[model samples]
Target: MSTSATEPEAADLVCQLDNVQGMVDALTSVRWKRHQDAVVELSEHGIVLIVEESRCLQAKVYLQRELFVRYGYSAQGRPRFGVSLGLFVDCLNTFSVPGHSSTIEIQYPGPDMQLLLKSLDSANACIYAEIRTRIPDMVSWDYNFEPAGSTPLSFTVKSSALKEAIDDLEWPGSSIQITLQPVPPSVTFRGDGHGNLQIDFKYYVNTDLLVAFHCDHQVSYRYKYKFLHATTSNIPASVIKDNRGSKLTIGRGGMLKVQHLVSVARPSISHSHVDSAGYQQPSRIAYIEFFVKPEEDEATGNDS
Candidate 1:
């Protein structure tokens, strides 16, 4: 087949990242349900991977353009495609090697495009895999969470503290209640089941636990513990070590939003470059966010 000069090539649309495992880990951190497929949207800014569960919750893993050493897209408009999340994660996992650093390159040609992944490690080891792609579904969950506009009761808590509190609680509960007020016990968690358990969050004199707390009116809402526990249960160890906190917001009618800032790429000397002063520049800081929605229930009508 003959190709024209103005035509786009199969390798024209490509994105290369220095740390493939970092991106993989971020996506897998929020992988609670095994959906058959996921949607990948490509644009000038970056790439976004969307995963949903039973139409109740949605998680997005974003890899911004700055995270990539090289990112290119020749399409006139944004391009989106769907691929098997399981297969995709498996392909990335094939390149996993202990004590080795790897880079990944992804290429998308055109219609009937196949997703290609190439990984190269410091040990000169190379791994490549190609998976098929399909047109994404027309229906997708919209995650337009605007806390500024909405009158939501929001607060921030250290991820480690929250994880520990949830772990210590007795499980097998049907629902979990979150109560926020403008007084002491600013935040409260109640698990209703065979045994009642309550974990309260208040300003301590010697500790910096709650970073921020804001509430207009005292509100209490119940959510499926299973759904709310997904994020806390599967928290990445690195997130806990880094002490990255999570911002939780509860809107009217029991809508819950959990947001986390995950460090995707760590600053390293190898990734740095020499500056004019002959000193190595610091590596770039890259991060991705995880958004989780909990299945909300009717108000419990309890103020205290």
Candidate 2:
């Protein structure tokens, strides 16, 4: 019989970090400089968080056993138990981040079993699913985090290489999720072949993950969706991505107010359409964005 599976409620503690009143009893792993200690394997059907230490410590949490310890339990008449590692990790990441964190799981699986072994385990601390928490206070002079109030140096979305895309665009940091949707073509303005049609987005760049730099520190900002040479007053509401309640308002059929503008030439994004002859032509655009911010720091040279 698996020991850990006896306590089902403990699964809830998998990915959370909170200041609890006490500690934990199971064997533990301290924060070593390199979180290279483990491998995160994700597949279509499931994901596995593995700890790869060549040498076994006194006690270590394995995928199989961690589920058992966290969700196993027993009762007087019925010895019932629940164990789900997926649910545990889901709850953990829902609350914590890919970065550093700690969590405590309490399992009180009914009566019958003696409390000696379970109660005597570690009670002073919680468990953690951690990664890079050691953000050094200082970056080498060579590195720079964009400071607030500065124009971000624009990059060729093409120049955003595979690795950069994987780091910033694909496997982006936490708490910020950005999505885009296509706006249907219109027939109000003369659209060149290069008219705006699609909206792209980047999240948690300025506020959450990349907060240390000048680009991130700024406070006043709004993002809006817009189309050139158009008045939005009479048009129905325009939706960007799936943000329903959060959308740009049109005063004139072509004009929309930009909200959440951190930095931009224009906050809102929209496309221009041309109606001539029997053909309705809409313009294609690379991408659209605006940068509305305060004066930036001199040292950062924000746009450089």
Candidate 3:
């Protein structure tokens, strides 16, 4: 069977692998951080957005909430709320690997988890991302997802038994889900009529950025955050003495790279494009991108 993680042929071989069930190691992971209501103050020169997040989420992994207002395309120009999005922005280090037989932890990166939160923190979002254990394709069954909580998520499956070679009694595979509760209160921002954000990176953001969070424009608001950014220069002073006091070391495989990126002009369209034959040329493309670094556990631990 194919055992490589980066090979194309591995797909066909991994399909034959066995179906598995899972139990949660911990479920009290999700947390809430802060919420900011945006407002606009018109001045003599220009208009500004006002955004204020709760102090709890300033530097912690907490929940964030924002209101996304959409204008329907019907003749009446009806306004509607698509989906109220919620996400756990931090606190992943508390999560433990599922068990001895699990390989999911060693397969993906922590940034994927963070990136997924940004995507899902929207209503009818353009993108939805999650860092879950992907089941092998050789199995025909849908992913077996169960919340660590008491509620059961339901879905329907249909397959031909008599009309096909396989029988209905056959089972394929099962996956796992760890239902979590938000730790801090979720952070929220709202838009007036324009549901877009503009991003700009600054060396220093004024302590009073809560105003920008309340934007009435068709652009993204501005905010400042701290991240661990160093390509190879961020190696920690000491190596793994133990788990109780290690943040993450660089080039060692466990270290996560934090880049200083300004997410500007997201969920927006530029008006400075060439349009011909009813096709509007795109002046700029807006989308947030994140990368999943390879596992450091691979080179160090045999079964980490």
Candidate 4:
């Protein structure tokens, strides 16, 4: 089996995850298609799964070491390989029971260099799967987002509300325009097609809905509706249930960056540690990021 030049051939990696469904949900967020391939990079910090589409859209899911119950890494360097994303997600789904939470043990680079996963909850009916892996192709996009000028064009909104607005704007428009201005401190989503539709979130009027708004100058950019929807289409239920907020930022050259946090802690259980004063820490969360390129056209009307 071929491996990255920085990594040794015979290294070993094993980890135990208490929240099987959490892993499933996190991975599913990036599974855009039924048979997409993802690049898996394992480091001392944790595992990173990357999936991209047509070089225009890319997403990453960071499974940090702290999220795992036990993370064992003895590799000389970071190891990266390619695996079938659909197969991996399907295999992990088998370990997730509706009402019963189970633990799963994950190991990498089996004798034949296959990803290994097994359910640890049931001894009699243990579920085990071995998926084939291959040498990963070079990732197409690694954009360094330019700063959004001095004001930092950004906003934070409830994930559920953001998802709803994006879904409702899925009409006949091929591109969606996003505008942010500091005058009234608001963000607008506009879809122009046979039937024009617009949704606005005024910071002062709906403080709770539009939690944070920062825009020094008026900036607007158009993006493919499909790409915009992908960022919120597969948002995990856990994110909505926790009432988490999604952050959106527009960098230089109209690059759009969307960030979401998915908790990996077991459900109905506390994964925090208390200090002497009985102050509890926050649950371990997985970080997800998406980068979407803007359309070729310049900003439309009302762009300062």
Candidate 5:
């Protein structure tokens, strides 16, 4: 297909963000695998970074267009390319200094199609880095989490509390078994090797911690500690500052989805945009989600 005249050429795509470090910090949170490359997708709306580990776990960091001071994409459709995440992150941190903030401008000039990063500091110091890009693999996995349908268990908890609870657990085991029931001891975290921890959210006792819970049938499943630990480790510091929590959904197939809301920008309360359908548009909120696949075993435990 011929390129449209209105479409952004590969070289004309550029994105500029006010807080470079914030972006860097968010990406670093999900840097679990050491040598994995990330696929970068650019569009008029914003940019998305996808990092996958062994096809067992996938983490996505989304930066909305409103978060950027200036964003442009001239491609007919979304443009996707691959680059070493570690290398890209290192380049971003090269200009980092204590108590200093830098504006970041990323450009993709045509021809060579190298990813160019230009960092400008308040003191007028400019640092430029050009990294090569590669054709992203077409066969990328997608996370299709259906919270509306037949999920056996779903709940929301404070990010800090979850982090602390996970950290407090013993790591002697390779897998951690999670048990959720309707009665007391609503949630239980059991280490396969040594420790047994139970967190109860009795209605008369502590209801605040358990934001929402819906589980008609009690369920128990086992997931790798290393994969689950990565979720807590990669939570952006900003998410903690905003006092955000995470939502977890466990499907019948032993698939777990963790969602964390990351505040991007403050909304203008006075004015709100209305779509063509006359629905009021809400404020922009970006979320980072992790999809984890559970190990298959005949001893999936009793949901009874």
Candidate 6:
């Protein structure tokens, strides 16, 4: 009897990220202690890391291909796998140095189907890690978030201020109510428990602080404090230091969506592309999004 040899499959995806610390910070933004496992989906455009809590709260980190030094994708379709978020973040952290920068080359579907990561900047030594990944068992939850009403109800505030507001309101109660009105063009956060605390951001007060606002009718919704906190609690200090803006939008059924942009490009390694004017533009960015479900008995105050 003649035996036939088996052929090994090639890696499905390979990419090199020059700004390791930036990627770390972006991933850390969505890293929650409660949900350790995250689903990773790879596509031609980029990679997306998703983490959810009991289908009520969901967070996604988008690592676009433009953010990488080199990107290669040979997969037939979008491939997804589940891996330990804590382990992945911890491993990436080990590759970053505070004052120094490193480039990391990543590959998926290795010989053993494990996710492979290697530090390419080291001169004498090479740091490598192989994290085990499993076939995704649970289907990721997709919340159809449409505009709340005729006009989209949304507001953008400085990241630092948003973080501070959420932190301060924690002492007041277990749930926080968000109220937006068109007449006054203001957004308010109210918490009632042992004490009451209300914080408002008026559109005309300071355009720089409030950034942007849109509300057609009066709308109010209450969300659990823990869920709301999780959205901004883990935001990296670098993001806040950059004076970025965190946008909050209320969708149909009082679904709250929080969005944050994290810069993953360094001044030295970035600037590979030029615009029509021939001016070098900064590298791409990573997007972080969180979706929190409102309380069971969410309040929808006066519509007019």
TM-score of each: 0.81, 0.16, 0.14, 0.90, 0.81, 0.90
Q: Which 10 consecutive residues of model 4 have the lowest summed lDDT?
A: 1-10
List, in order, the clash count of every candidate structure.
0, 65, 39, 0, 5, 0
Cα misplacement distance, residue 33 of candidate 1 (Å):
3.2
Residue 61 in model 2: shift from native, Å?
21
User: 44 in model 1: Cα distance from truth in Å?
Assistant: 1.2
lDDT of 4 by residue, 91-174 (tens): 899989987888987888776788877788877988877789999986647788887677678999988899999999998598
Candidate 2, residue 17: Cα displacement in angstroms equals 20
Least accurate 10 contiguous residues by lDDT in model 6: 1-10
Error of 6 at 185 (Å): 0.9
Compare the candidates by lDDT and give the number of the best one.
6
Q: List the residue pairs that clash in candidate 6.
A: none
Model 3 regions more than 4 Å off: 1-30, 33-53, 61-97, 105-304
lDDT of 6: 0.85
Q: Which candidate is the best by TM-score?
A: 6
> Each model's RMSD to truth, in Å?
5.4, 21.6, 27.5, 4.6, 6.3, 4.6
Name every residue pair that clashes in candidate 5.
Answer: 7-74, 8-74, 8-75, 11-110, 29-234
The collision pairs in model 1 are none
Task: Using TM-score, rank the candidates from best to worst.
Answer: 6, 4, 5, 1, 2, 3
- Tens-place lDDT digits, model 5, residues 121-165: 555666778788889974468866654336448877777777776
Segments of candidate 5 deviating more than 4 angstroms: 1-12, 95-98, 121-123, 148-152, 198-204, 263-285, 301-304
Which regions of candidate 2 deviate over 4 angstroms? Answer: 1-4, 14-35, 38-149, 154-304
lDDT of 3 by residue, 1-304 (tens): 2112233222111111010111010101111113322222222222122222232111111110111111111112211111111221122221212232211111111232111211212255322234332222221212222222232211111111111111111222111011111222111211112232212211123212211121111211111111111111211111111001111111121112111111111122344242321122221111111111222222322111
Global fold similarity of model 1 (TM-score): 0.81
